[model samples]
Target: YAKTSRTELLHFTVGGKDAGWMDKRAFTATLDKATYSKMSRGAKIGDAAVSSKHGLYTKPNNTAEDGEKIGLGSLYANQNVQIIQSAKLSTGVT
Candidate 1:
């Protein structure tokens, strides 16, 4: 595990690519690793900028159109899912 310190830099990967330096002026809080990377890299599989203040490297989120890519959200490991409705878009009886 990495040491605990305010200066402790976080290292992560996006779409199999490594994240670069995250310094004080480079990155800030409320910017989670995944979210930050996505914003920075312009929501693509490689490095780019989503906003002036955020750098990311992945597709930000999913719309109904992202059928094959929907599984990307599942990479979070701890995320839990439960179907709230049926294929017919009716209230599930179960």
Candidate 2:
């Protein structure tokens, strides 16, 4: 395990790709105060949270039309779905 400090960013990978970094706040939020304290004292955080039990879901082989019918609330909504990052649809950069 890599040495991780409270202020340092925690890097994580999914499917052998760089998913992103978990800042101190986000990383702490995942655990209780005791667990965070233990980690702060040098205990390692396991990769169990990255498993299927977490929010990660498998994409279904379905068309967009079918996805709409199933409702966006469903876990199998769409494979290419992404969280909206901003109010603007496009910045006209292209």
**Each model's backbone clash number:** 10, 0
lDDT of 1 by residue, 8-94 (tens): 555666799987545443444342122121122112231222122332223332212222333433243343344232222112211
TM-score of each: 0.20, 0.20
Task: List clashing residue pairs in candidate 1.
Answer: 37-56, 37-57, 38-56, 39-56, 40-48, 40-49, 40-55, 40-56, 41-48, 41-56
lDDT, candidate 2, 1-94, per-residue tens: 2346546566888899988777644543331111111112222222443322334212221211122232233243323343422121122221
Which pairs of residues have clashing backbones in candidate 2? none
| Backbone steric clashes in candidate 2, count | 0
What's model 2's lDDT at 9? 68
The regions of model 2 sitting more than 4 angstroms off are 1-6, 28-94
True-structure lDDT of candidate 1: 0.34
lDDT of 2 at 13: 88
Model 2 is weakest, by summed lDDT over 10 consecutive residues, at 31-40
Model 2 deviation from native, Cα RMSD in Å: 20.6
Report, for every candidate in turn, its global Cα lDDT versus the true structure.
0.34, 0.35
Estimate candidate 2's alpha-carbon lDDT, on a 0 to 1 scale.
0.35
